[model samples]
Target chain A: MYTSIAGSVARPSEVRLQSPRPSIPPSTAQPEPVGSAFADLTVCRHSVTMSDPRAAIVPAPAAARATDVAIELLAEMGQDFAGSRSIGETLRRALHRIVDHLDAAGGALFLLEDDGRTLLCTASVGATNIEGIRVPVDRGIVGRSVRSGRGELVGDVRTDPEFFQAVDERTGFVTRSILSAPMSVRDERLGAIELVNKRGEDPHFTPEDLRILEAMAASAALAIVNARLAAALVEQERVRRELELAAEIQRSLLPTPPRAGFPVVGINVPADVVSGDFYDFFELADGRILFNLGDVAGKGMNAALLMAKTASLFRCLGKTVHRPGALLARIDAEIAETATRGMFVTMVAGILNPATGEICFANAGHEPPLLHRDNGTFQAFPADHPPLGIAEGSADTPLPEATVHLDGGTFYVVSDGVTEGLTVGGAPLGVEGLQDILREAGRLPPAERLTAVTSVLTAGPRPLHDDATVLAVVGGSAVTRPRSGSAAGRREPASEELVRVSVPSCADRLRLLRQVVALSATQSGCCQEAADELVLAVDEACQNIIRHAYHGDPTGQIELSVHHQGRDLIVLLRDYAPPVDVSRIKPRDLGDLRPGGLGTHLIRALTNRAEFLPTPPGGGTLLKLVKRIR
Target chain B: MNTGMTHRVERRQTGMVVVALEGDVDLQSSPEARRVLLDAVAHGGAVVVDLSKVGYIDSSGIASLVEALQKARQGGSRLVLAAVSDAAMRVLQLARLDRVFVIHPSLEAAITGDR
Candidate 1:
């Protein structure tokens, strides 16, 4: 028996000596004793009872007192784990408090590392600091407790085979008895808590001590799990923010919107934070627009990185390499040297000559480019070579280059994502669907037409599985005059003189000449379209006289006359300037994409027969242009 | 709008320059048109020439626009023709310049540079 501050009570160890199974008297069970409330909280494996009813009169029985201490210790440890932000610091403090409460020589808390095969000592309170000690999970008493998912109570370490001696030998700590309890939440085994050598007369830990330690281990396991989950969430958020910034930067590298009359336009939509598809177009110094569209084999970061590399390489080298095939070959070689195996790029590169309305292009394992003609016909040019990076410099064979005249037509180049894109019905939008969309929006401007087509695919419920991109080049309308049987083909009864006027050879007089021709042609039974053509033709003819014959001199004189003969209108202009070689007055080649030389072409295009008339007088040049009324 | 004698130059709050020509653009008036267009291009901002009120445009007028465009391109600036009249459009189409020069349907569209 021991004497407590409240009253005399049987010591916990001495009570165990009294009987194997004790019984509580009826009187003791009826009265509520002070500090005995914790008796119910203690998880008792064996039923505890008072031997005598008289002994229960005391404030607390030996077993009840021991239960109170255990409940208090567990409550304090729970508060420590819950309130502390630094779990490491809180755990170390917990181990220290537990050691003091149990009167143990030392204790250590081990946690399972990510590898799951090793136990790392994370917190310790003992003669030796084993805070960074590592041991295999199958090595010692601690490992055994964790592996078995149970608590271990060692009465004497020298006799126990599970006790590992290397740790004590290294730290110089004399370990006698040991208590190890595994930390677990449900079926998940975290690690184990180990206490060595009881400090009092009893050098071994009691079964009650093992139960208390196991309860503390459970709380620590839950706290560590929560901390790890929080860390993972924070890391995920950071990666999301980084990806958003990368997408914005990728957008900045793309070309700006072209000027209103610019011939080429493009659009790109990515399925994720970054895109594997890219397109670019820029005007070369020679007035031809160079353009390209590429698709990497995959999606996400690796593909996006390759997309950037390929796009930039095209833009940088395209400025100098004029041929589409040669440019693709160069890019292919560059990419093949560094690109990952099994990954490749499908690309279509082209150059558009706005002046001649010609497009020269090369396709490398890409979707065929569609040419929608003004006369309601369609033409497609398929790939002539394999995709880049598949075979080094795959475009070695002279690619089958195609030149198409865009006579009031449009050329469309798109990534496979456009054709393979899902529609509202969850089916792949085949080439036919894309063509239908294009025909529906054919009359719209080129940019709006592309938008209309892309919107149909993008408007579906599902996200795009691949990157979608489009590039369009709209052709100019070809000049076509009304034929003989058309609405402007009305015939007059007789030929008549339309107008006769003369003025100084000056640019200012050209407009007056245009008005004269417009009035005369209208009066001579010409339709509004034919009259407009006559006005422009005469205007251009007179301007040529002022610019070439007069040499921009305002002193020279010019005579303009318009005559109508049945279905024919003839315009005559005589400039009083020194006439020279008539054979040298030829218009420039129309293929030349330059300004100024177009005036001569414009006159010839508007008239059926434009020729230099036989030198009329002593020192003047006479030019006549004939236009059929139809 | 038929005056053929007046032109207005406006600098909007968006830092865009607008040169509005209200008349026929021909050999006689083209020199003045060229001066206004070039000066706007030299200002180092996007320039939009509104030709909605132009009744007619001759080759000389087209030449002046081409010269301004060349100068704008040399300066790394932008120049676009907006609201071109039908008569002028026909002339440009005849010259095959309708595909060369950037043409917008509205002055606002030209200034915004969306297309």
Candidate 2:
């Protein structure tokens, strides 16, 4: 019987149940028009019930013979499945045994694909090789059996309207009768087994044969389901290992941590198996450190892939581009060309000269990179342009660059993840929270400081919803702590011009301006106490402009410029409000004890001279305050 | 920007509402300082402005203290400043309010009414 089976069909030594049917050519099989009630139609008319006592007592010799064949088929299938792990081989051997026992001309075993949309011929025996052919789940008698979860029997195929003749046209096999039984375990309809043209004098399949086949299909379905589960678990493990390898590769792509006290350092905390946020800093031959921090728009593999592309592009092009604004423009053009739709990166790229304490950078719609002066105040540089990939091509105009002389200050560039990350109180650690963290962490070394600041969101009990990244660049120049009266350890400004900035004449913006003045005074070789005095004087001057000149109009503009010359640091404040009479702007008597008059007195006391300079061309007042460094 | 690193208001068991100021209390933060000071003064009780952590204070801050002191005077409440840093002290003395308002060398001294 085994030799006959080998001759019938060229079955492989090992059968993979779900292997792709690449060997089989596309069949010219046409679909059959099956009536909605085709499942109700059966060839088993005049069926004898073995459960009836009369039928069992007067059982025909043929019934006894059929019972013996059923036993042999079941026993053979049990051994065939238990001995072989190859599902296709077990199924093929079982199909052959069913054909041999039922005296059929041919047989085919069809199983539903994973999608359950098509029935694929997994095994075939005798006459025509229909193995690897796929029929839609809505076509043929096998489809009806599987969909309806019932056995189908057609006594005469030529007259049966539900009979599918396309297989015969292609394979040239004549079929007289068909018996197909659904292979199912409980509610799960696995597939179906179909036998064609019983080779006997009767020439038709009987109800008894259908019942025996249904029982056999049940056992085959259970075995097939188990094999499928085992295969799926193996596939899942393979994918898991591949992801771990990919994560390792991603980690290796990041630059190594700098030495403990290195001015520039970064940290990244990923939310998932991978991160979409990235930061990089490298030193150029000119003794300048180039650094960048970026966050891709989305999460997971696509964002990770884009992060790699953007990070590597920055490292490669950044060396040659030199200028941060132009380099970011080039990166934006490159990313816009191939980036996935609806995805963009918010990034800030900058270069810092540790010796000069000068930083030149461009913000690309990222969070405002914070500049923390040693005075315990913050100056945040907001993005002047849209993020990368949103602006399609390189701009004809040079991208705007923000240059700051971080004299004894630390500049921080961070992704929004750090700002948006939840704190221990389950609220977002906003910019204010970051400021508080930096105020304390600023004293630590660069690498340790990044860790200490980021740990607020990373080490908390609540999970991070997004990736958090931070990059810090500490300035080289040193300044005396505020109120340290003597100029013991202070550095002079590198050049005469300290800082010139224009801001809206609003109360909210005065803090940054005050910090600028304070930094300028300290940079001009004043002690911390003198710097504080200068900051106080400038804050009073700006408050006077906002309250008396602008009349508390928040829309008015104020342009302030500080310059260092001789022994004095000069502050020039230009406001859009109409000029005020210098003589009439006298401080009110100190005994008045009013909120409106103290700003004026403080200005005169802190500076050596407070006078309105010549009005600018724009019909606005220019107030200059000179405080000689003592 | 007010990270509670700058200023905080707390009630002491000695019936004094101490407003602790830190970092820079200039034009930007003086209004908040004034609000906290005025709120303490509005209680019509003894109020102490803690300047131990204050690095710098402009006239705007001094104005808040003066206005709060005037309100305390109108309400017949005790108002004093504690731990005034030299920078703040200079601003107060420049305005000559140092001679007007009672001042303390330490917070404990102020809480104990030790001047």
Model 2, runs deviating above 4 Å:
A1-90, A113-118, A132-140, A158-161, A200-208, A395-398, A424-426, A440-449, A452-463, A476-630, B1-76, B80-86, B90-115
TM-score of chain A of each: 0.63, 0.62
Model 2 CAPRI quality:
acceptable
Q: What is the fnat of candidate 1?
A: 0.50
Q: Give model 1's docking category.
A: incorrect
Candidate 1 TM-score versus the reference: 0.55
Q: Candidate 1 chain A, which ten residues in sequence have the lowest lDDT sum?
A: A31-40
lDDT of 1 by residue, A33-128 (tens): 211222222223212222334333343456466655655555455555555667789789988878888888899999988898999999989778
**How many backbone clashes are present in model 2?**
0
Q: Provide all candidates' interface root-mean-square deviations.
A: 3.7, 2.2
Candidate 1 wrong stretches, greater than 4 Å: A1-97, A100-103, A129-139, A158-161, A164-174, A394-400, A477-630, B1-115
Each candidate's DockQ score against the native complex?
Answer: 0.22, 0.38
| True lDDT of residue A63, candidate 1 | 49
